[model samples]
Target: MSDTQNMLNDFRWIMDVVQNIDVGLVLLDKNFNIQMWNSFMQNHSATLAEEAIGQLLFNLFPEIDEQWFRRKTQSVYILKNSAFTTWEQRPYLFRFENYRPITGKAEFMYQNSTFIPIQGLNGEIGSICIIIYDVTEQAINNLELEKANNQLEIISKTDGLTGLLNRKSWENLLETEFQREAR
Candidate 1:
């Protein structure tokens, strides 16, 4: 095979990987027009690449806070550095439904996303790539753990039978009050 054929084969393999990856990938131009939307995005958003391409990002997903998103992308474009957002910071950029059986309790998919600056051949930042990871499982687990911890705290402080503060709670409160009085 010729060198050109080898290059073409490599390109095809890369494209296939990008399209089929579990994470969502989106490329947006300076004007926030969709340049590329991969299979993960299509599956979640129910929007095909053909339909998404060239459309304004905000127009398709009105739920997205246009001002907030622009602020994030603007920093990437100016700094040429990547910016990240976790499910903890902002649940999701796109309000995709949670379809995974294990995390069925969650109404919407929790996501962690990265904003990457894509530099052109001329060494100028031209586009931004947004990578979205479905983190619903992790988020749900963390939330459940927090709730359990809160319940444990309450249980530790209250009487199981009477639902009133236990002896330990009263002693701690008394100590705190004594310190305040002393001050």
Candidate 2:
């Protein structure tokens, strides 16, 4: 092949690497149609790459939470920074497996997802990439920590009979929310 042809071939191969990566990788055009859906995502979702590629996401997965998608996509367009979502926030968006193929348990599941906006070289907006990573164990640990904190809060501020916040925690949380809303 000529040098120019070889360079084009190399570019194709590099693009293939990004798609074949072992994560839930998806690319969406600026209009939010699916541009690429990797093998890992296809396998987990029981969808064919051909069927998903170039399809509008809302049409393909009608079950998707529209409000959630709206907020994240809005962030991509308005803020231009990656947005992350932990498994606890919305586990139904993507399936997560926390176990190794050979030795791990099947029931364990968790994931973190990120949405990244893509900009073209000409300073024009182009596309976005959505990536997901398993984080089930970490989510569980965080939940445990939260439960402990809840118990501590109860003990630190409680009216023995009425089971209220002993006037202190109640004042704090109410004031905090009130101040935030005022801003």
Q: TM-scores of all models? A: 0.95, 0.65
Best by lDDT: 1
Global lDDT scores for all candidate models: 0.95, 0.78
lDDT of 2 by residue, 51-138 (tens): 9988988888776676778877888877788888877766546644444676444355566788898887976557888887766557
Candidate 1 structure lDDT: 0.95
The alpha-carbon lDDT assigned to residue 120 of candidate 2 equals 77
Q: How much RMSD separates candidate 2 from the native structure?
A: 8.1
TM-score of 2: 0.65
Off by over 4 Å in 2: 95-109, 140-183
Supply the global lDDT for candidate 2: 0.78
